[model samples]
Target: MSKTVVFIQGSPRENGNTRALAALVMETLAQSGVASAEIDATRLQCSHPGCIACGRCQEGPEFRCHVDDGLARAVATLPDYDAVVLSTPVFWLGPTAQAKMCVDRMASLVKCSDAGALATPLRGKILGLFATGATERDENLDILERQYRVMAEYLGMPFVSALFPFCGVPAGQAAADPEFATVARDFGVRLAGMLGGRKCCDP
Candidate 1:
């Protein structure tokens, strides 16, 4: 069966550098014959945005994300995919507020057993980040990578990333650079490799 990947659009700002790079990556994956879909955090219609720690989802293994909202419903099905790529712009030394909030609320997807064992639906799936930030990489983008690496390690998911620093200086500046597109295409192939896909056609 073909592997499925979900691109989570974590940027609140549309038509920006991050979004452009994300589109390039998705196009590569499509040309490689990988099945894909997307979830835009900006468009999530959630009355209760972020995790409330209500323990409703933890009540049973079958229950996942009990919140009654579009985000809850969207995240509840993440287990069905083979990979998830969070595409966001770095803001204030981290992922955008929209992206971070989505990640926070996804905590509801973790189902802990009565035996005190923690299990999340995201297990055994690949997790990747496509993030662009301003300033030097070590100063900001690397910081974001370190946080995401820790997150992937704890979640037991293999991690990959496309971190582009010194981007979006003038908002969408990176989108005009051919080098950025090349890097994004290469990163997409790397992500697809985790799902056992190879480039069969040009993107």
Candidate 2:
């Protein structure tokens, strides 16, 4: 079976390092015969006020957000893919506000029960993070890594991550740096390996 991965872009800047790396990775993914899509967090942030915990989704006639906004609409389509990658440059060592809000609104896709939170539509799908930081210290990316790791485990999705978390480059430089480009392309190749596995494709 074929696979598709959706990358949620968290940078507001049109040509930042985050996008640069993502472009390389996406190119590799395309060459590897994997399909990909992207969602801009900057656009998605305006979609909803926030997840209100209205319980409407969990209590539902339909298991989804009742907000009737863009984020809600975008999240409803997540189950169609084989993988989800949260890609963003670090802001104070965490995701940008736009990205965080997009993630918050995704609560609509998960239903919490007495047993625990269940990411039914998203469960078993591959979850990944592509976090770039200007700092060379690999530790600078710990917060973003932990954030994605925790989310993946909680949602019961198999977790993977892109290389060069530090990236250690300025805005828009990832494309020019041959080393970073190699890392980024290899990340896509790695993701292809994960998504191509029979276990990942099983329903």
Q: Write model 1 residue lDDT over 28-73, tens digit each, in one string.
A: 8877878888888889888886888788876765646778898888
TM-score of 1: 0.92
Tens-digit per-residue lDDT, 1-203, candidate 2? 66899999988888898888899888878777788999887786354566777778878645467888888887777788999888888888777888787788788778877887464788999998887877754666776787789989988999988646556566798789988887788788889888773322334
Runs in model 1 deviating more than 4 A are 113-116, 201-203
| Residue 9 C-alpha lDDT in model 1 | 90
TM-score of each model, in listed order: 0.92, 0.88
For every model shown, the clashing-pair count is 0, 0
| Top candidate (TM-score) | 1
